[model samples]
Target: MKLVIIDYGAGNIKSIQFAFNRLGYEAILSKNPEEIKTADKVIFPGVGEASSAMKMLKESGLDTLIPTLKQPVLGICLGMQLMCLHTEEGDTKGLGIFQTKVKRFSQNVKVPQMGWNVIKELKSDLFKGIKENEYMYLVHSYYAEHCDETIAATDYEINYASALQHENFYGTQFHPEKSGNEGAKILQNFLTL
Candidate 1:
């Protein structure tokens, strides 16, 4: 199957490509809209500032292209945050695929909760083989807030939507590609979709 990963000048494309390669899938990293639109599966992965990421996406036109996609689309980290309607990070605007906003975690807890964290309240196909309260890799300061589309929840300083699903659109705050075996399964499930 053809997997097109959006390379809007900011995504951590190599890790995602490595993940799919380990699964025996030849995933292509491309910024071309045609490739993205026609792919069997699409991954929107990123690791960077929201505003700068959005700026790059807008320049490439993927910001407008992604939300309208009919096939399965997965966003990781900043890509997931960009799928939301807005973000307090840099006061940025997002693709609005999910009606949620990204915000900074409460100051009481550590910023950028980097490392493995448990994700529970699983309720979608994305978590098909994943167990409840299973640990996943995370590294972020901003998070998507509670929303109807939220399928998996995680708790750090506060409970928030760690993963979201709405129709063919899917997103994860944690790095499934970096989360090991269970994380690999999640990516496999996404590919199967």
Candidate 2:
């Protein structure tokens, strides 16, 4: 199957490419609008500042094209944050694929919530075979607030939506490609979807 990984100068991209490669799927990294339009599956992965990332996407015209994709699309980490309606970070506006908003984790808990975290109350095709409360790798300072689109929840100092799904669009606050075996399964499930 053809999987397109939208490249807009974000980090951790090669790792994701490697993850897909191990699964016998070589994800194409491109910024061409036409290539993205025809891909079977799309992965919008990013790690960086919100405004800058959005700027890159907009400059490449992906900022507009992404939200219009008809196939199953997944956004990881900052990619997920960008899909929200808005974000507190950099006072940036998002693609509005999900109605919720992204906000910085409360100071009560350490920022960047880096490392392994367990996610429970799983829902949607993204978690089809993954067990509940499964440990997944995460490295983010911002999170999506509670909303109807939340498919999985995680707790740091407070419970927050860790994964979200709406129609053809899906998002994960955690990096499934780096989340180990269960994470791989999630990516595989996304491919099948």
Candidate 3:
């Protein structure tokens, strides 16, 4: 199956590419709308600030294209935050694929919740072979709040949505590409879908 990784210039494209490579699939990194539209599956991975990332997507016209995708689309980390309606990071508006909102973590624990954290209350085929409370790698100062689309939840300083699903759209607040074996399983699940 053809897989396209949306390269809006804000994602960790190489690591994502490598992860898919390990899964025995060659994923193309492209900013072209035509290529993205025709792919069987799409990955929207990002590792940057929300506002700047949104700027890039808008400039590439992907901001408009992404929300209308009929194929299964997976958004990772900052990419997931951008799928929400809005983000507190710079008061930015997102692609609105999900009705939730992203907000900065309270100062109670730490600014960015780094390292491994277990994701619980798993839902969707995205966690088919994955078990509940499986550790996923995460590094973010902001999180998508629990909403109707929330498929999995995690707790750090506060309880938040770790993963979300709205029809064909799937998003993970953690980096499945960086989560090792379990991460690979998640990506494979997306591919099989």
Query: Using lDDT as the measure, which candidate wins?
Result: 3
Q: Model 1, range 1-193, lDDT digits (tens) per residue?
A: 8899899888678999999999999999899999999999999999989999999999988888998899999999999999999999899999989999999988888898999999999998888978999999999999899889999999988899999998999999999999999999999999878
In the range 1-193, model 2's lDDT, one tens digit per residue, is 7889998897679989999998889899998889999999999999988999998988888988998899999999999999999999999999999999999988888998999999999989779988898999999898999899999999998899999998999999999889888999999999999
Q: Each candidate's lDDT (Cα)? A: 0.93, 0.92, 0.94
Q: Model 2, poorest ten-residue lDDT window?
A: 7-16
**Candidate 2 structure, TM-score to reference:** 0.98
**Candidate 2, 192: how far from true, in Å?**
0.3
- Model 1: number of backbone collisions: 0
- Residue pairs that clash (backbone atoms under 3 angstroms), model 3: none
**Cand. 1 Cα-lDDT:** 0.93
TM-scores for the candidates? 0.98, 0.98, 0.99
**lDDT score of residue 40 within candidate 1:** 94
Q: What is the lDDT of residue 103 in candidate 2?
A: 92
Error of 1 at 106 (Å): 2.4
Residue 176 error for model 3, in Å?
A: 0.7
Candidate 3 local lDDT, residue 139: 98
